[model samples]
Target: MMSWSHHLIITPILLPMATAALLLLIDERNRTTKALISLVSILLLAMNAVVLFRIESGPNDFENVYLLGNWAAPFGIVLVIDGLSALMLLLASLLAVASHVFALARWHAVGAHYHSLFQLLLVGVNGAFLTGDLFNLFVFFEVMLAASYGLLLHGTGTLRVKAGMHYIAVNLVAALFFLIGVSLIYGTAGTLNMADLALRMPQMEPDRLMLMEAGAGVLGVAFLIKVGMWPLCFWLPGAYSAASAPVAGMFAILSKVGIYVILRLTMLLFGSGPSAGFGADVLLFGGIATLVFGTIGVLASQALGRLAGYSVLVSSGTLLMVLGINDGIVSSGALLYLVSSTLTIGAFFMLIELVERGQDAGANVLAVTMEAYGDGEEHDMAEGEGVTMPGTMAILGVCFAACGILLSGLPPLSGFIAKFAMLSAMMGTGSIGTTPGAAVWTLIVLVIFSGIAALIAMTRAGIRTFWGSLEGTVPRVLVVEVVPVMFLLSLTLLLTIEAGPVMRYMDATIRTLANPAAYIDAVRNAVVIEGWGPGTGAKAGGSL
Candidate 1:
């Protein structure tokens, strides 16, 4: 009999997948039905998260694998949900719910197929988190990418279509590389199961180890391409900025998937030791370069959308750099920072869309400032024509300011806490006389300096756009506009309140990561199945 823990692992993925199917049969105009269905699925997924969290929090030591049709491991399809997978699933579910709520007001603007694609995207994300096999991860990647193709260009505008095409092209190439890498690993290891592969990797001959590392390196490149680190990140800002608001929020989760995979497989397969040189350096140096480059882009970008997009790049780089640090403390801090930065930045992106909507309603950002300054609407107008006022720019300004402080790493905000954790970890490492080399020190310096620069840019832009001068028209604000921003901000605050618990969770996860043998042991002892081929049999694939 399948365990209840297995059900928890499958529910989040299944809920969205099943919901997408049901939603497809419903009429496009039946917003009420569509919403109710979505809500139900979201609730179910949320419940699954709560259950999985409870399981992980217990002293029982959870690592449940569900085999489709009771076929057992190796040959059969499997879904493995461990602490890492559960945490990611919970985060993805929370974001999905928030994004769905935000879409309610904007759905009309987004047109048909919007909700469908969104659900499909969630399914892909959930499946990616749950799948225990390598090829299945690729399958989920394709599923998400196809939905993104539709969602990215939903409105069919020229700019959006062009950007979407570029996004699709780049990812398609990356996907192909991912496939090639997976094929190579399967051929060499003779098994595609992740846990099994992890158990077998360390025993491989030196030449075979080189071959495996090469394949893994190729796979890492594909993920790095997705994560928007340095050179591979060129397509991100323009593409994300051009996409719809909900799409942009979805993309926020998308980039993180790459890093999630890297963190997972790197620790699981390659072992979290100093010997993983090429991989570690690639992440470290590339991450530093990405941070500096993204900071420069953030400084130069004028549009709020583009700035938020670049901020994603910077955050990805920062997080990956922590991954490269290879220390439990640093990795733990990085994990915390990832959650903080994603929420903070995602909220900001949503807020930008709201601001743009308000501006479009004839209330200019400047009009909000003028209203506060007692300058008449006419005075705010550029010509003899009358300009309209938006009631919501002030609210948008406050949200923007909060996001700015969070992004810029100002005190008391959650962003500050994340960065402080990272810097403190790094300094602690240095103090232990391990002496992170000159390269690490250089990266540390550049990251700090670029952060300062990015802060200056955000301040200048926010002051000029929201508080500095009067503009022609103001955008009207709606409850829909404020709700998403509030939702994300509340999450940010929640992170602050439960810092101790969250940090402990991260540390526990880090400890698990630092010891891959525990994972291998769990899988090896879990079960033995009958009726599989020799290579795919119960025994672990040939040792690394």
Candidate 2:
């Protein structure tokens, strides 16, 4: 029998896969049953993720790496769990639980097979996080993209279909790029396993190293596109804005998948190897440009949906820039920001739909009127009467303010804590010549500017939605819908309350990622059955 320790590494992937398959066989009419199954499955996944996090935090062990079919490293598939993967697993599971519960309010019934697609998406994400090989990463990427395609078009609408089509087309091109890059890397390195590739990279010939670098560049482009890096991310805002609330909420984690891969590969293959500084300059500049663009987008957005979408871009850009900095202290802080920002953005997306339900009618009228006739005089957009719910406006206002505080890096929230940590790390580097470098200044300026932009945009949106008009209709938000939003926000508060432990964990995770010796050893030293091959007489899981 496999040890529970080994099982934990695979459960994040297998549990979701099994649940998704089972969900597929169930009838769509059985919504209650499906919701229960999805809820339970995700809860279990979350519990398992927490267990993994605790285990990874406690000890250094050999059982963290599991070789499928008892095949050796660089041969069979492997799933490795460490601090980063465990943390991602926990975050993803938390988001999944919140998104699924919120979907139960109404979005799940918006299309057939919603629960199945959701579970499959989780499977893909967890697999991507855990996979020890590049090829399996690609496989999981495809799985994730496939599920997202369906989720994006979940609700039948002209806008959703058009946006989904664009989303699909863009990703298909990215996927092709992914395949080409993978092919080149494999051809050059003669191995698809990440740890083995890292081991082999320094031994490569000059020409093959160039080829690998070229492949990495192509792969970087694909990941950058997914992460909404500027210029390549024209498709992101519209696609995200067009998606249903629950789908959009889940999508907050989707982009991070690309970011995760980049972080993983960069640290694993080039942290201290021959290609240590490869692509660092590109990441630095590209991230800066993306941040500028996202800030501009945030300032220009007129609708909450588009604004929320742009906020995602801003978050992506911030993380990308920090990664480019390549300092472990900054990276640890970025990880904290990553978790805080993702949860806030996901909650914001769900909240946007509810907040906009009442405003759509008036906004539509204003838009049509504006298109037909010019603004002849100064007119208050808030002149209309608003409908009031007893406590909805207050609750929504508070949540909206929380999101703003988090997104804008304001104080008394996790976002503030995260940004402060990052800023502190940058200033503490001690590498500055009496004056900070241009890059340091640029980062500091952009961080402050981005926060201000988010504050302005969120303030405008909240004012317009909650307090603008006294003549609007009360939005019919269900308790189920509101609970999930509160849950996500509460988690952010918890992150603030427990900032010390969380920051320490992030610091430890970054250290482990920076020093890949333990990771490499775990993979290299995993036990394998002798004569292991397809159809061979080697029984699985036996000692050599």
Candidate 3:
């Protein structure tokens, strides 16, 4: 029998896969049934993710792997569960449930098979996290990209379709980069399994190592695109801003997928290798540039959606810089920041639609136009258009303010704690001395300035949307539509409440990442068959 631990580890991927299949078989006309089924699957996936996290939380001595087709590591497909993967799985599932549930309020009906695509997207994301090798990672990456293409265009607007086309084209190029990179690495290293690659990273011939590093650099670009790094990130804001609110919320975690891969590979491939610190400078400087660019975008944003979109870039740039720092302390704080920012951005994405529902379709344009020119004639025409903010609008306003606080790294929230942890670690520890490098100081200044930019942008936008405008009205919001936003925000609040334990867990996870041997050994020694069956020699997909 497969171990119970293995079962839970595989549940995230397999459950969603199975759910998507079943959802596909269901007719689109039975929308309620499909919605309920998809929702239930996501809930179960969430529970399984939570359980896996709890399992990894205890002592984390070994990463658990389930080998498929009864083959051992480096030869067969395997699903591995560790602290980072578990945390990411939990985050993805939480975001999925929120986005999916919120979609049922109306967005689901806009597109056929929205439920199925949502589950398929989870299959890809969960698989990407769980897969033990580069081959499966590519497979899952494509799966995710394929599903996202559909979801990005879910509501079918001119904006969405146009954005989706560009999104697909860019990702296809990235996917091509991914394939070439993987092929190069496999050709040089003789294996596609990450652990096995790590085991050979330091001992490879000089020529092979060069090839591998080249491959790794190519691979990094593919993910850099996903993570919205500068130059490559130009398409991100427009695409994300054009996406429907629910889809945009779910897409928040998508950027983190790239961050996860980069972090994983950075440690496994270069932590203690001949190639140690190979791309550190690029990541550092690129991250700094990205942060600065994102801050400019944030401050210049006229629409709330674009502001939220730029915030994703800020989150990506920060984490990328953290990875470049390569310090366990900084990384731990980056993990916390990752969670807080993702939740905040997701909540903000959903809240934007709700908040904007009360305003005229061109209210953003009107506000910008008035600021740039004048509202001399337009304002008088709508003098009595404003209404008192009611309970629903008030709730949305509070959520919006919370999002701004979190995005700006304000006090009394997880965002503040996360930024404090990272900044302190960077300022206090400069590799070997008390004085940090110019790059470190640059990152610090950019982070602070970025926060201030977010604050200024959010305040200006909030004023236009709430106080400054005289044409706003109370939007009709459903309990379901509003609840998910609160749930996501509340989790950020909960992160604030449980900062100590969470940071401890992040530190432990960082420690696990610091040791690549644990992962290599776990994959190498994990049992394919728990015990030999006495029958016809058939069991478990031999499954993972």
Question: Which is the leading candidate under lDDT?
Answer: 3
Error of 1 at 420 (Å): 0.7
Per-residue accuracy of model 2 over 1-544 as CA lDDT, tens digit each:
3465667788999998999999889999999999999999999999999998988777544277777877777888988888898889999999999899999998999789999999999989999999999899999999999999999999888999999999999999999999999999999999999989999999999999999989988988888899999889899999999999989999999889989999999898878767997888877888889889999999988788889898888988888888888988889889999999999999999998888876655674475355469657755558564355568877887899999999999999999999988887777643322445778788988998999999998887676667654346778889999888999999999999999999889988888888877688778777664565442433223110
Against the reference, the lDDT scores of all candidates come to 0.76, 0.87, 0.88
Give all TM-scores, in the order shown: 0.89, 0.93, 0.94
Report the C-alpha displacement of residue 442, candidate 3, in angstroms: 1.1
Report the C-alpha lDDT of model 3 over 332-375, residue by residue, as the tens digit.
Answer: 99999999999999989999999888687787887788788976
**In terms of TM-score, which candidate is stronger, 2 or 3?**
3
Better of 2 and 3 by lDDT: 3
Best by TM-score: 3
Candidate 2 versus truth, CA RMSD in Å, comes to: 3.7
Per-candidate RMSD vs. true structure?
5.1, 3.7, 3.2
Q: In candidate 3, which residue pairs get closer than 3 Å at backbone N, Cα or C atoms, i.e. clash?
A: 540-543
